[model samples]
Target chain A: MRNIKLTIEYDGKRYLGWQRLGDSEKTIQGKIESVIEQMTNEKIEIIGSGRTDAGAHAKGQAANFKTNSEMARNEMLAFFNRYLPGDIVVKKVEEMPERFHARYNVKGKQYSYYVWNDPIPTAFERYHSFYFPQTLDMDKMTAACEKLIGKHDFAGFSALKKTKKSTTRTIDDISIEREGSMLHFTFVGDGFLHKMVRILMGTILEIGAGKLELIVIDEIFETKVRENAGETVPAHGLFLDEVYY
Target chain B: MRNIKLTIEYDGKRYLGWQRLGDSEKTIQGKIESVIEQMTNEKIEIIGSGRTDAGAHAKGQAANFKTNSEMARNEMLAFFNRYLPGDIVVKKVEEMPERFHARYNVKGKQYSYYVWNDPIPTAFERYHSFYFPQTLDMDKMTAACEKLIGKHDFAGFSALKKTKKSTTRTIDDISIEREGSMLHFTFVGDGFLHKMVRILMGTILEIGAGKLELIVIDEIFETKVRENAGETVPAHGLFLDEVYY
Candidate 1:
């Protein structure tokens, strides 16, 4: 059996997300698997690095599947592009080692969220950005980002109530920058919990707006309470930028 | 009567461009007019600089309408933003001279066309750019662009079959530049004929691909035959970048 690693990019505006739901073709994984089934003529199960929430985009999402078909890499790539919807694209496909697994071998990930800071709504970026439509105090937001960088239990920042598994994760870096009328927040970490990035963005926005004090992040970190963080931001602004192995 | 000039921006993916058609609410002009009518409680006519084809976008389109309402500029701006679709925005509004017409007083205009040059389709920019998977020779395209500049009769470059008016037009400047995997073509001229920008892009693309000779532009200018130039590119890739008065 040959293991094929696929680099996927998708606009999740109309998709449920990266994971396959039973008997439903509305998800990104389901769409790709359907195309692969037609190409390989076999029922194959593909493993994704992780799942992104509904309406969350991905640029360099990784996945792997075992197929007995001997199709070349370029041929498979072309076939996938031809069959897949315009919003979802298989950027690259490569033959992986027999022991290689997409989900089990994931090392790190990077996510970026865009907040449109203009008072007037942006015509072109209506679908991709969170239209905050308010002035954001970047200095304070940047300070909050600095405080967020480190290994910590992010349970307070996630959507989960209580976790059986450890919520301790290492955030290698966090950067807040402005591009024109948009505020960009980039996070690189070992792993992220459910709705963790969105919650973090919400808290930062709240801090920027002076609705919450800068110390709220520290309070949430110490208390490990979900309600301490700000409300969860929309999923549309978030992007799974890169997945590393 | 106070004439309010509006600088408009819209994503033309859904609308029928910037012109109003019989009872159709899909046009950008129609949407603005309806909002203006509601604001003033009077049926008013709004004039645009020119008509952009259906599915064509605009960033700096200019329009003007007469109204007796003494609404402040900021108030009007806020009102327009609140009423207009999320894909459309009134960027600026200013009181203009009574005689200043949006169409008649136009001095120069600028339009831009975006071509995605990568093999893999862009996830974010899919709606904004034309996905041209084929390789484009920028040097050859630039050479073609250089030949296109100057005062010339652009009848052959337009989509119009017959015209009583003068087809003589002056192309002030043309710039072809690359930003990452996207090729941007900007054209500045006193005025453009129907589909003239799109036709020019198509011819330049052909020249870049070695499908047409560099001298075809000169040939089209000399012949003044509509069939001499290349095909018109899609409207989705074209944008009315700026309207100068």
Candidate 2:
């Protein structure tokens, strides 16, 4: 068997999520697996680097699967794209060593969230950005982001319903930038917990709006209580940008 | 009474067309009129620069309406955008002279057609671009575009169902540019016939594919027969860019 690595891009607007769940075929993984099974005439189990919730897009999501067919990289890319729907695309496909696993061998992942801070709405960019019309304090938001750039127990930033045993994760880098009427927050980390990015964004936004003090972030980080965290932002603005291994 | 000149933008994928038809309530103009009627408690008729077919988009469409309401430009812009659906936006509102008209006072217009020439489909840009996997000869396409640059009767390149009394239109400029895997064809003209840009793109694509010779363009122009023209391309790839007066 040959190990194949696939780079995927999806609009995630109508999907339930990335993982396959039961008989419902509304998930991204289910859609990809169904197309692959139809092409290979066999049941293929694919592993993704991580799960992105509904309405969270991805530009360079990585996945791996074992296949007996010795198709070329370009051929596989073309084949998958031909069968996939308009909202999902296989950007690239590569043959890897049999030991290369997409989930376990990942070095880092990057995510970005977009906010449209303009008073007027944009017709084309409505789906890809969150509309926040209120004025925000950029300096406070930046200060809060700087404090989040190190290793910490991100328990407070995750959803209360998450069942992950360990809540500690290291955030390698975090930066915020503004361009005209759009603000972008980029985060690089080894791994992320459930709804971690959204919760962090929500916390920063609260600080920016003067609803919470910037120093409150440290208290929440130390407490590790879900109630101390801010609200979770919407999922449409979050994008799983890339995976590096 | 104040005459308002509104700059509009829409993702026309959901609308039947720009014009209101038989109380369908699904047209772009119908949506705008309903919102205006609700805001002012009076029925107002809005005139657009031209009609865009279903699935066609607009970036800077121009329209004008006469209203007695003493609303400022900024307030009108904000109010219209708030009432309109997320897919449509009134970018700007200006109080123009009563003599100003969107359609009759227009001097020229610009339209652009985007073609994705990559082998793989693009997930994010699916609605805005046409995917063409075949290799195109850019030199042939450019040469054919040059033939259409000067003022000429574009009757042969328009749709056969067009019922305009005059079939003669002057094309001020036509250009075809290729940036990586994206091909953009822009046309500036005094007026355009129905589906003129799509047909022009189809004819140029035929020349690029070597299916039709460059000299056939002149023959079709002289014949002025719609049957001699190339096939009408799809509507989703066309964008009404701007209207100038």
Candidate 3:
């Protein structure tokens, strides 16, 4: 069976997350799978590189599926885009080796959280950014971010209710930068636990607001206690930027 | 009476137009007026610098109203923003002289039209830009734009059903530029008749697509007949960039 790789972009505001759930078909995977079944007249299971939470957007999500249809790559892309909703788009389609798996073959993933720090509220960017009217200390936030880089047990930063096999994850890079009225936090890691990015962003925001110190982050990581971590920021500000293999 | 000036921004996608319409309270002015009446408990009238058509967005639309609420400028700005819809924003509020009228004191206006000249359909910017898959002749479009600059009786380019007192208008500047996959056309003018910018954009797009010659634009303007003009483009891609006095 030929493996078809698809690059996806979606505005995840109205979704119930990427994974399929119950009889409710209001999911990104469910929508795509239903469209594929309709076109190919066959039931196929598509695997995604990662699952982004509800209200979290994506720009370059990767997925793979096996299909026997002899449709051209361009035609498949066009068909997927035509059938999908306006918020979701299949950017590219390519045929890969039979052993190619979207999840197993992933080398790393990058996520970004956006913060609108301007005093005045932004109407157009309300959905894409977390609005914080309070003044932030950028130096303190950057110091906290630097401590997050490299391999570490991210159990304290992730949600306590996660059922992952392990909480230890290797973070390749973490950087915080400000652009005009927006602050962007980018994290590249081998894998992320449930709500890990949002929780980390919340911790950084607390540090920036002078509520939590940089040493507090290290103490939480060392203690491996989820309760010691900062609150989980809302999902609307977080985005799955890219999945790399 | 002190004239309260408001610098406004709106998405305009859901509005009928800037002016109030019969039975339909979907106009931008109507929405603002309703909110103002609720805040001040008075029947307030707001005069806009120009009437933008339905689906035409604005970045710096100017308006003025007479209110004796004794509210500070910042309070007024904050109160309106809190009550207005997410798509509309009052950027700034200022106390002006009694003689300052939004409609009568306008010296010039700037409008911009965006065209997405990409083969792939865009999801996020679909509502804000016109999609033109075919390649355009930028040189030809630039030449045609140059001809549109300067004073002229734009009766041929204006909408046929308009009931304006004068069709003569002076365009101070016209610029057509391409950035990446988007083409932007900006017009600075003393005044514009109904659908003048849209009709001009349509004509330029036709010329860029090799359907018409550059000299044909001059011919249409010289004819002073509405039949000589091209079709009016959709209002979604057009924006009232700013109004100047």
Q: What is the DockQ of each candidate?
A: 0.78, 0.79, 0.52
User: Deviation in angstroms for A240 in model 3?
Assistant: 1.9
Tens digits of per-residue lDDT for model 3 on B105-135? 9999999999988766666666678887788
In Å, residue B245's CA in model 3 sits off its true spot by 1.4
Residue-level lDDT for B55 in candidate 1: 91
Q: Which residue runs does candidate 3 get wrong by more than 4 Å?
A: A160-164, B160-164, B177-179
On lDDT, the candidate that comes out on top is 1
lDDT of 3: 0.86
Per-prediction TM-score: 0.98, 0.92, 0.94
Better of 1 and 3 by lDDT: 1
- For all candidates in order, the CA lDDT equals 0.91, 0.88, 0.86
The residue pairs that clash in candidate 1, if any, are none
| Model 1 regions lying over 4 Å from their true place | none
Error of 2 at B83 (Å): 2.5
A95-147: candidate 1 lDDT, tens digit per residue: 99999999989999999999999877899987688999877788898899989
Question: For model 3, how does the per-residue alpha-carbon lDDT over A1-245 read when each residue is reduced to its tens digit?
Answer: 67899988888888898987874377888888998898788899899997889888888889999999988888888898788887888988989999999999998899999998976676656778898878999888888888988888888888756555778899888888888889888999999988999989899898889888788888988987877777898898988889998
